[model samples]
Target: MGEVEHVVGMDIGGTKMLAVVFDDQFKPVGRFRKKSKAKVPPEQHINNIIQGALDDAGVQKIRGVGMGSPGPLDPDTGVIIDTPNLGWKDFPLAGIVQDHFGVPAVVDNDVNMGTYGEWCFGEVQDCRNVLGMFPGTGVGGGIIIDGKLYHGASGSAGEVGHMTLEVDGPFCGCGKNGCLEGLASRIAIAKEVVALAARGDAPYILENCGTDLSKIRSGMLSRAIAAGDTQVERVVRHAAFYVGVGVANLINVLSPEAVVLGGGLVEAMEDLYLDEVTRAVNDHAMPFLRKNVRIVPAKLGDDAVAMGAARLIHDKLAS
Candidate 1:
């Protein structure tokens, strides 16, 4: 090609950080990871992660760095406004990485970046308007309209999780009630499972976790559902119903061509969960909106976020 180019893609998660070096064609050259230490100085922690990736790739000239970070980040300014899990506030992540590595840097919400990744190089390429959602420890979303990422006025858009659902339902981590996240996220599912096990109602989940309900994870719940546990199916179906409702609301508003769902919970639950979720969306959404929007799972899996971060840089270069 014209020149050998490389970009560092870093995913700063709540519990861990992963950094990968990708060649000109976006294939991984090497990768590194470290336990996320929130209490550590934000700048120091980010620098360490970057250095780890550099060491793994054994490179001296990094073209650029793109980070998929937890929200809420000021994407325009490359500042991390705050992330509860990372204990960071208004952190100048882009500047820090750029100053340390002598390369351009970009940052965006992890889920948003994941959406970008899918739109650019994954399953959503055929879609002009897309609602990308991730249901993991929490629910987050990113919207792409006309092939451009849409960040609302305050640089804080696509917060599907915060959408009010019941108006007076369970409390969400965002200090709201009846949020889709409150009703349908992994934490919410686990809480439901815990309560059921407490009442001796979820023997299958209990058995999957070896009677220690605390050990029951979203993965175990998936396994229980796969093994045909009614209790597990019930919990998942309830969560899927709420998720579908939330997605339906999105379709009504954005009128996206596709709604791509992914993340740990969606991946683990597999097709059944997605089918139930799509069914709910189809039933609840307006007829026109429901018919026009296609619901599908993200194809990139866990790599979507990191790849999207890398795509941010690539797109910038291409443009």
Candidate 2:
């Protein structure tokens, strides 16, 4: 008799698109997932996923929609300025979604959505200020200040991966050298592991993944570490240390209550990564800042971005 009230949350990544239908209370009612064909226009894929989820949930009334996408985009205007992974430039993602669904739509950086999800529903909910750093194929950062997301003047305040860690370090995906991401990301670590395996230094990796760089995933690396592959452990520890350095700098500047670490690598090698990162932060951070701050792992796993997107729509409607 009454129309089912629902909203949609979408997470758009280079390889996949996930759409979830959420009831008014933020419980997931239905879900749809599809590959993101980078060579094709994103509109159709996005629409298909949302519609599929809605159809599965049998919902007729959608309050709004929210999306988490890769950045260098304008959140204020909900435009995807450029995403190297997807080759989308100057795309009005939110507008397209809104037009298709006939409801309000909001968009923000994927990692920012993850940060918001953690802040609102994950481990950092009680903290007024929190910093989120995720090390995946790349490293991403997000900040919550005074219980609000802080989008800088350019709406890119939390591009912490781009921060220069060395004057002349390895080149980053952003075409810059010495970025934190270049020094310490899953991609960066994988490169080192592959090279070592090629040279016969990491027999475990070579025996498992062969010479294929693409095969050197976080799960594989974690298995190598578990099997006591010293080379893999060293490389991963080094990368985690650099990540800690970046976290230390953020602590010195923002003094957040907690620093949340997430991503595939962190999830797989939680103990190893946490141990190294905790040590590095304590070693490098200012004594005063390190005293009270807690460095923790993200709890939401893969659902963070989607849940955060849903929360964004809810917040917008409430405000």
Candidate 3:
């Protein structure tokens, strides 16, 4: 009865920004991705990125916009209290986009959106409670309770990456000792993998990436492990073990129905992470609490946050 409308969804992170255009049926028609830079202002970057997607889709107008960004932000007011990674503080992200595009916009934490995307369109089935862990440039997490994203009083409820695993472990970016992010993030894994490369324990990484943390991305590490780098495998397994420890703690506390693993690290080395994390959860969690809890890889990959953002805004505006 009415003309079909399209919408844009975006995921802005420390490393990259991705925008996807979705049609009435929520199918992607166009997408664009760009490496993130601290020098670039969010307003400039989002404008270019969203325009890129619109251009690719050959669409002139969109109904609304949705975005996911690194948090300490307010969903109700659309104010970003702070994003250490992006060097943005007290930024009004949703409002900026709304004004720029002349349409309503919704924003949420990137991890929460990613996990919510999984719940809406990924492998999670018939599950009301879920725990999502993503190990990337840094580790992040999200929680689902009774089929809804749980945003505690401060909208930082699902910050599982800050959970301390060891009192005297490596220093985390969060200025803490032995937070899980310091032990399990891609940055942390690269730190140890570099040392191994120097010692010739990981010849593949040494020759391929040359201890260059910037070049040692998740896909590269996975390739190195596949190239007979047993030491690299060991390092990744160690990180997975720590992640498992965190997951174990959550399992004990929340008794979630499913635990979803996503992000660049999990996307590249799904089998390895699954094997180690599953082992750790089994070893540490209570038998009763861990029962019937499915641990699975996220099916959405890079599009999770974007899709979730799109869906969230669509629902929000409809209601």
After superposition, the stretches of candidate 3 with alpha carbons farther than 4 Å from their true spots are 1-4, 38-41
User: What digit string (tens of lDDT, one per residue) describes model 2 on residues 1-319?
Assistant: 5764688888988899998999878889998988888454678778888999998888867989989999888988899999988889999999998998789999999999999988888877889999999998899989999988899899978999999999899999889999999999888998999889989988889998887888888899999988878988999999999999999999989999999999888998898888988999898999998888888899988888999998998899889
Candidate 1 global Cα RMSD: 1.9
What's the lDDT for all of these models?
0.84, 0.90, 0.91
lDDT of 1 at 248: 87
State, as a TM-score between 0 and 1, how close model 1 is to the true structure: 0.94
Model 3: colliding residue pairs: none
The C-alpha stretches of model 2 lying farther than 4 A from their native spots are 38-40
Q: What is the lDDT of residue 130 in candidate 2?
A: 96
lDDT of 3: 0.91
TM-score of each: 0.94, 0.97, 0.94
Better of 1 and 2 by TM-score: 2
Models ranked on lDDT: 3, 2, 1
Cα lDDT tens digits, model 3, 89-140, are: 9999898888888989989999999999998888885899999999888889
User: Could you tell me which residue pairs clash in candidate 1?
Assistant: none
Candidate no. 2 TM-score: 0.97
